[model samples]
Target: MEQIALKAEKRDISKKGTINELRRKGKLPGVLYGKNIESSPVAVDAKELLKVLKTHGESALINLELEGEKHPVLMKEIQRDTLKDAIVHVDFYRVSMTDRIEFNLPLVLKGDAEGVRMGGILQHQKRELSVKALPADMPEHLEVDISGLKIGDTLTVGDLKMDEKITVLDDPEEVVISILAPKLAEDTEVPTGEQAAEPEVVAKGKEKQEEE
Candidate 1:
């Protein structure tokens, strides 16, 4: 849990157009708040924010500097424009390093599963794990080794090895990943020429009986 420094400035929330203009100016519109502090509208350099996100990921602990005051914050939500694939707004939640906080940590799968190499399908059921821990004890992500997995094997949250300081909040029985047996292609049966002509012969026999 390395904390990265970010600078922000207080912004006017009275006008929505001002926020759009801020984005046009390459400033990311965001808000900072905590359990004890009031929600404050702020803006930061969009490029700088992107750099931090690229380097440290969304789970990175951020030391937000606003008006000469520093706030230890976590990125709570990021609103993006789907059509343009651009980030529109972001929410920063302030945190206390000493207090236990709950957040979703990313799960990373490492190594190729033996089952997959043997023509089995590998399914990743859970991508993130819910955890509660002190900010200082938080990990960037959890890694799981899948090389030992065989067909029909499953890995659950209970199987995860983590620090004692971090408490997993998700159900222990929840499956994280599993190796399934390979799907077999269905065999298609083609009708022989006589089989296909049987219906026509039956119809002709019924026609002759009706005439008689």
Candidate 2:
């Protein structure tokens, strides 16, 4: 729950051309807003923001230093350039340390599934779980061990162990992971329409012979 330090400058221009100009100068445009707080347009060094994202990820608390005033915030949304794979814009949500906030935590699978060794497929239905916790009590990730899993066994959200301070927001009955039975040859080798019709054609020919 350590907060990462970042600095941002207030932005006056919001036009598309101006935003592109800022990006060419290695700046990223963003906005900061929260309960009881007025929204403010801001910009920060793109390289610095990338470094913070790489180190702290999106769920961690950020100490956003804006014009000498420090705001504890969380990254709410990030828009990326799909082709260039660069951050285009971001949204920050200010938060109080003691307030409960909801966020998604990654699910980590530990240990190999016993069913996998038996030719079964290991499937993960939920890769992350939504949780509510205080800023200081948030966990980086949740883990589930699958070493004891057998074919047809399913692990649900209710099966996970969590910290007392953290409340899982996901449905308790929702599946998180499971070991599925191995696929049979027939299951994988479905016959084409023509191939399937051949058997029906042969059956009809036998009926015609009996009639004759």
Candidate 3:
């Protein structure tokens, strides 16, 4: 994974109202925590963080530079403003290159499925895969080829090919994608004028019997 540099400053204010004031000045509140490291509250430039998010997405490795010290980190979570779709707060997890990390990588379909071209429906069952690997061995996304898939065929987790350094944490039998055969439209039986005619009504307890 590619790493981008981000600068953060130690935050002294912890109140919600004070954080809102910091945001008004183009600062975003965030926390950094990791194994064997002290958790610290910090603030980052909103514009710079937005740029990183746009270029690297959520899974990118970040080089967080704070107080003249550099820490390799990953974005764990981001709180956003629901109405404006803007980032409100962020969480960062410090990481080491030699340590194994679990990441949810997106699955990208590489080719058009043969079944889809043949009028079959292509169903994507899994959008992401949980994988554990060294930080340096992590991938931005996993590519799944679907060109060879035929109708009624399914691609499972076991079918995926990955680097030996990475291990998938999901079930091998789990389906990732499948091509379903096209459904045949059912025929509706319409009533003709004679068949639509109402039958003659009989009084209660009185009914006509069929003659032999």
Candidate 4:
């Protein structure tokens, strides 16, 4: 919920070549818009943006310092280059601290499950949850403890302990994680002595009939 300050500058959105040139100069192209503000093209230092994201994560509120004004915003979308895995563009949504906003919150699992130690398979069913919270009440991520889970045990959205200020939008019955029994190898039967002898007896009976 801490607001991190980032410097941004207004950019011209006239040509694709200009956007490419901005990226070449180590600047990332982005758009800033909201209910009260008009859509505007902006640019920020690519390295600085990455550093902020790495340190505080995308859930943290950002104070975008543009010209002499600062806009309270959230990182809405991030586009990346498929091959190079580089950030290409970003979208910033200006928000009010008092208004509630909905977004997907990442789910992080902690502690090794007891069932896993007993040869059980641990399945992570949900990686994120839809939540609605004020900007100041939002958390970076939700952590679920799995240390006490036994085989065939499941954790659902209803089991999550959340703050009173935040509301989870997902179905309460949706499963988040589960510990399953490990698959056992099929048993291969070895023929008994009598069973093996039965085939040899049938072969000898055919030979005797042919001799007769």
lDDT of 3 by residue, 77-171 (tens): 99999999899999999998888999998898999999999999999999999999988888778889999999999999999998889999999
In the predicted model 4, the residue pairs found to clash are: none
Q: Please report, in order, the local distance difference test score of every candidate based on alpha carbons.
A: 0.93, 0.90, 0.89, 0.92
lDDT of 3: 0.89
TM-score of 4: 0.86
Better of 1 and 3 by TM-score: 1
Tell me how many clashing residue pairs each candidate has: 0, 0, 0, 0
How well is each residue in 1-212 modelled by candidate 4, as lDDT tens digits? 78899999999987769998998899999999997899999999999999988987877789999998999999999999999999999999999988999988889899999999999999999999999999888888989999999999999999998988999999999999999998765345667789879989999999999999
Better of 1 and 2 by TM-score: 1
Give the TM-scores of the predictions, in the order they appear: 0.86, 0.81, 0.84, 0.86
Residue lDDT tens for model 1, 1-212:
88899999999988769987998899999999998999999999999999988988898899999999999999999999999998888899999988999998999999999999999999999999999999988888988999999999999999999999999999999999999997665445567689889999999999999999
Query: Model 3, stretches more than 4 Å misplaced?
Result: 14-16, 187-212
Model number with the top lDDT = 1
Q: Give the TM-score of candidate 1.
A: 0.86
Off by over 4 Å in 4: 187-212
For model 3 the local lDDT of residue 113 reads 95
Model 3 poorest ten-residue lDDT run: 203-212
Residue pairs in candidate 3 whose N, alpha carbon or C atoms collide under 3 angstroms:
none
